[model samples]
Target chain A: MEEISFASQLLQYTITGITIGSIYAMVAIGFNVIYNVTEAINFAQGEFVMLGGLVMVLFRVTLNIPVVISFPLTIMVVTVVGVLLDRLVIRPIRKPSVLSMIIATIGAAFFIKGAAMFIWGKDPFDLPPFTGRNPINFLGAVILPQSLWVVGFLVAVVITLTLFFDRTILGKALRACAVNPNASSLVGINVQYMILVSFAMSAAIGAVGGIVITPISLMEYDRGAMLAVKGFAACVLGGMGSFYGAVMGGLIIGLIESLGAGLISSGYKDAFALLVLLFVLFLKPSGLFGSAEISKIRKF
Target chain B: MKLPAAREALPSGRTCGECAHCSSSSGIRFETGRDLPVKKSKNSLHLIGFGLGLLLLPWLAGHVELLGHYMDVMVFVGIYSILTISLCLLMGYAGQISLGHASFFGIGAYVSGVMTTRYGVNPWLCIPIGMGVCAIVAFVVGAPSLKLRGHYLAMATLAFCIIVTIVFNENVELTGGPDGLAFIPGLSVMGHPLDSIAKYYYLVWGFVLVTLLLSLNIIRSRIGRAMRSIHGSELAASTMGVNVSKYKIVVFVYSAALASVGGSLYAHYLNFLSPASFDLFVSIKLLIMIILGGMHSLWGAVVGAVLITFLNYEWLHYFEEAEGMIYGLIILVIMIFLPGGLVSIPGKVRSLWAK
Candidate 1:
């Protein structure tokens, strides 16, 4: 590795951190949405990213489908998957003990992974560049169009989800459901449908996240588990229900990981994320934007 | 057949609550209390079986090497039983979830590893110190995190578990880095270095008996009642003056301490320690064991631990590429169909037979 100047090194690290943070934020956003209404963490949420990228790879490489068709198809499949997940796993044991529900989510996570693995082997599969194979030099550091794609998609998703949650009638209903399921049910709002919607929307966002970023990081069936952990941490660190907090938490986690790895060692990068997670939980428990509702959200 | 006879006694038209079987069978058997004669007779059979196995172990060994393996497994099972029992109480009784318990296991291992490897501390002294360290860490983590109910608490512990794995994987100078500590000196008990499988087996069995008794005692005591109340519903428990949060912290810390003991035993028995063994998978395995065995029973934890450990050793290789898939599938299937786990099946059968 070439030794760069300390000033340049610090700048490089920060840029890397922000780019990674952007990806985490996107993943976290999906976590926040599902958690907000349904109280299911959607453990398979991260796999939407993996599946999107994998589908793109399989179509473009294995099946000879063009990127244009493959990407949209991938997004559609993931949405359907999200809906299916809600219908099958989340809805059935919705009345079980809290631990059972959590176990069910975990089961869903594995089931999805197993399906994905059956479809795609254990190898790390790659995708053609979303923009181009070239690197851009806008940040006084190495930045790829894919990095910009990730950041751009994160911004777009946040804005879109924020509007959907805050301004729309459906969004209001969803929020109402999250705030008080009993009152929402009493008021004739379909709590089950709201939960299903939440799951579908979260899956959609996660799939989009996968498509945009997979061009940078190669897709694998197993990538979702780690991503889910990171996403969960981001939501937790940012406060579980806060949309903006999930975004910020993702960014902060990404930054911590990137910078921590660059300054210290890459080997411990995961530990850094885990440390931040533990610290946030142990110290605040509420996280950056976490509110009482994060804890108040009932699994039972 | 044995279970059918046990079940034929329940009243034909009544559905007594879930505890009927537990009360009849275990009778809240504890470290100190009246030993129901019938329960003792049943339990004594197992005790006698264990005794015979211990006596015949050396003769059956036929070789020193296989004997060592048996010793190793026993110690692991003993330590794991301790950890599993703690988790059983916390989740099944106290109504909390932990995703990061392996971190405490690792913390215990790493503490003992560092003490013996770096500081030249005796393994015996280091064991308690490791447990103490893990207890403090658990308390620190639990104080805030435990306040959060259910899934959040699980996630918090998961975070801690990941952090510990990360630290153990990295931080070479302090933790032997990721390659893990090697050539750890054998542990000593009562001024003798525990070096043989027969001796170690006895040692581990001793701990298992102690932990099993303690856990059963707690389950039968007033503390156990509070834990059960908490499990029923935090609100109801709180309404009943259970001091829900305090009990949570207590169990969380105790579970961590138990995990520490497991970790300590694991490190000394293997004479080596690695981050991979104490990863989140291990924690999940522990959970699955407790869940599969029947969370409501103390023996459930023991059964789950032994069954999973043996199964992992014997059959996991068959599922190689899809090990995780198999594990998740089995657990899902068990939870979906069995609901209460294998232990509950007997009760369910009894109820059916009553009909």
Candidate 2:
């Protein structure tokens, strides 16, 4: 269509893609961490994003509170919800037939989504700008400051998590349980607590993603479903059971989406990650960083 | 990492004397052919009963209170009954979660639409073509993704469904885009188009009988047993040389084809085919119907499908202020307490009544 330099447009789209990708990456990490610990995908993990955005809109927009306060408060509330969910919905069905547990989470997701919609309405909320409203021009390509905030926060969080997982004793205990829960429990590692911690931590990360990308994507009650799909696709493309794979998969999916849009129709761009999901599943099966383990649960 | 069974749990903690589910501390004993198999499958008697029910339905339709609405409700019941049976075949028997099931339904409808509109192909002939196209596409998608387990496979299928909808939405030239195709010729036989709703009623209802017969046969056949085995224990099934992957592929294809058939009939009956009609929500609704019906029996599929269709139109209507909220609440409560579904209730009640 429109006349535009290939290099400039490519560069512009790539930046937008990476910015979007970082959010997807964050959501994937959140899913992977919880899955690694609990062996169940928190279907309501998507709701954490909605909760974060809703809390911000309620506090920052309605009550006119500061962004700094609104963001952390929302994350804390979501973390608490995650803890309660682990204790109730997941704990009772932790035996075998993990499929039922997953279904239970889906039930919980539906309830939560309905509740979110009822409370916040389906309309997209006009999220206030997170950073200063200034565009940075690099080689004649204009970009938003909040875009930098998204990419910066994504990198920072990844680095922090890598450090936490490798360096901290709690992280070690968590990984230890994911590897061998029985061994970890025998070693006084409190596997249940670790699962709860992962859930809470993952929820917190999802909320962070909500706060960062609210300006660009805009906050809405129903946005959780779309974000969840992209995140889930990222997790699948990179590897279901692998943590680091989520990051790479998210970035790759983001690029594929934008580049696919530039090359093909923009409407079909969303299908790119899904195609890669099916492809990687066919070729690798375990994912880029995923370790193959024979599963005992019913394949849902 | 495998904890001992519940009796083993007794040595570790509480015994059957204390635990609610256990009795005499022999552990949570499973029904190893200890109980009677399902005895209430819909049979020739049910066909007779349904025939009577339909005969009675016309008399009921004559009521001043219930006229056109009842017929509309019955038509929906027919449509959803087919959808739910297809889902029960895949999810209940095949042990596969397909979030993109709506795509097959859409393809069937669209194929029928394109055939009738473009090539002027006989609508009856297009039925097989719709089924064929759906089966082939489902195979193409399901075959490769079967390797992925749980959420991965579900997500992949979900992606497939979303992409299909997007294709239907974006390609305006072919699909008529968002506006959807209209004036679909009534499903005719050998060039006779049935124009009236009353005539179409018998048409859909007749097809539904065929669907029910096929489902009943499948569920009672060796193929059905293999599917159940695969669902119950995949590893054990594989060890018994059940060709787990092959059975899954077959069932998935079969389910998709049935969905297509249902879709084609729907397009012709409704005389409109839109992308919005078959979406992820519709697929999930189908899943809900099977679960609600009690996935263990074909009758459950029918009961669930009929119940859900009626509930969506009737019960939810009571909550005009919060219809969506009511639907979500009903789903949650039903999933929690009645996972086997309303179909199980009749037998349970019968047993209780006998006691």
Candidate 3:
């Protein structure tokens, strides 16, 4: 094996960290979307990403479909899955408590993971890079095209979501519902509709993350739980429900993990992210951007 | 079954209400001062019958063709029953869920496995050492996580569990990595080693009975009522002078210690230790067992553990690929249709009959 320069190694780790961090950011965003409206963490959020990658593989590799066509198709399928989860598992409970809802989502997560395994088997599947496998050299370091794609997709998602939430009527309605569901309902916004939309939007985001990250890290059935944990750590660190915080948290966690893997023992890479999460949760439960008063008022 | 009728009389949905039969709406409240003797005598009778059944089980298994191969499985049922029962006390009674409970179990197994196999320490001594480690770990973990409300404990414990599992896999010099530690010594009574499956079964179930007794006593104590009060409403519990945080942490530590004991038994009985045995799935499986059997009831824990163990060992063996799907399906179906769990089946049947 050829030894690489320290500068190149440092740059390489930073790029890898940012790319992975963006994926965590996407997962945190999905968590925020669902949590903002429903106040329940969709534990199946990672499964949506897994489904996205696996389904993308089925469409792109097996069917020989173009990336443009398969991308939307994968998102749509995962969105349908999200809708089914809300309808079948969540809606049936007439009165839901925080504990029960958590249990229900966990059950749904397990079910989705199991179903994915049955469908795709135990093997990890890979997707071709959006462009090609060619590495771009910059500042004495090599970067994969897929990493750029992942980072670019995250930026696009943030912009689109900002516009949708800020300027669009539907997005404003969702924000209103999130603020006060009963009052929003009285004011002519359908809270149920907002709930459904949040699930759908979050699932789509998860799918996009899965699609972009699959080439860099192979997608497998069991990987969802670990990803979900890392993403959740990001959410808690950045302040749950804050989009800006989620992005920041995701990037920080990603960088720490990448640098830890590169410089420290690689075996404990996942632990570094989790330890940060625990420390953040212990020291400051409200997170970096979340308000303690607001958290106190919220039920779960 | 009679107790569930009283449970049904409570006005609240999931929260145990202060019904007429009992002043305190405790989780799995079986006997009250009003009808203490009848309920107490009946419980004692059931206990005697269960003890007899357990004693005869191995003998029956040896004689009956259909039950011949189930002796080993029954030992696992006993070990898992201890785990589920401890979780029931924490989750059902105290109303705190620890999603990373398998970590304590892993600690117990690894400590015992390492001490006996590598250092040649006595297996019995290792059990308490493992419990001590678990207690300290649980205190540190619970002190921070339990201070917050909602799913923080669940998430924190889960992270802790994952880190522990990773440590078990990566620290090859100590844990033997993914290959795990083998050739663990078995438990011995006086000088005689518990080598036979039947002997191991008896030893495991003996521990289960003691655990069940201890848990039952805790439930009936004043501390138990305080725990139930906290479960009903944390704010209300505090106003009632219950040191809510203290109780939660104490219960968390107690449950962790019990889990360690269970893990130690598992290691000694199986004579091996593997990281996979104490991974995330095992933790979830323990949760599923408690939920399936009936979270609130001790009998429910035992029933859930036995039934799930049977399914894993006997029934689900044929459907290996569908195992995860089936476990998930069971959780969904049970939570949706019968959240009260299998222990509620008799009450449901009685209600239907009355209707």
TM-score of chain B of each: 0.83, 0.85, 0.89
Clashes of each: 4, 0, 0
Sort candidate 2 into its docking category: acceptable
TM-score of chain A of each: 0.93, 0.92, 0.97
Docking quality class, candidate 3: medium
Write out the backbone clash pairs for model 3.
none
lDDT of 1 by residue, B221-313 (tens): 567666766666666667656698888889888888988887887788787888898887898888888888877677778888878876677
Q: After superposition, how far is residue B44 of candidate 2 from its true place, in Å?
A: 3.5
lDDT of 3 at A163: 97
State the weakest 10-residue window (summed lDDT) of model 2 chain A. A291-300
- Residues A117-233, candidate 1: write the lDDT tens digits: 877878888777778978876535767878877788888888887788789999999999888888999999999999888888887888887777777778888888778888888
| Candidate 2 interface RMSD (Å) | 3.3
Q: How large is the interface RMSD of candidate 3?
A: 2.7
Colliding residue pairs in candidate 2: none
Ranking by DockQ: 3, 1, 2
Ordering by TM-score: 3, 2, 1
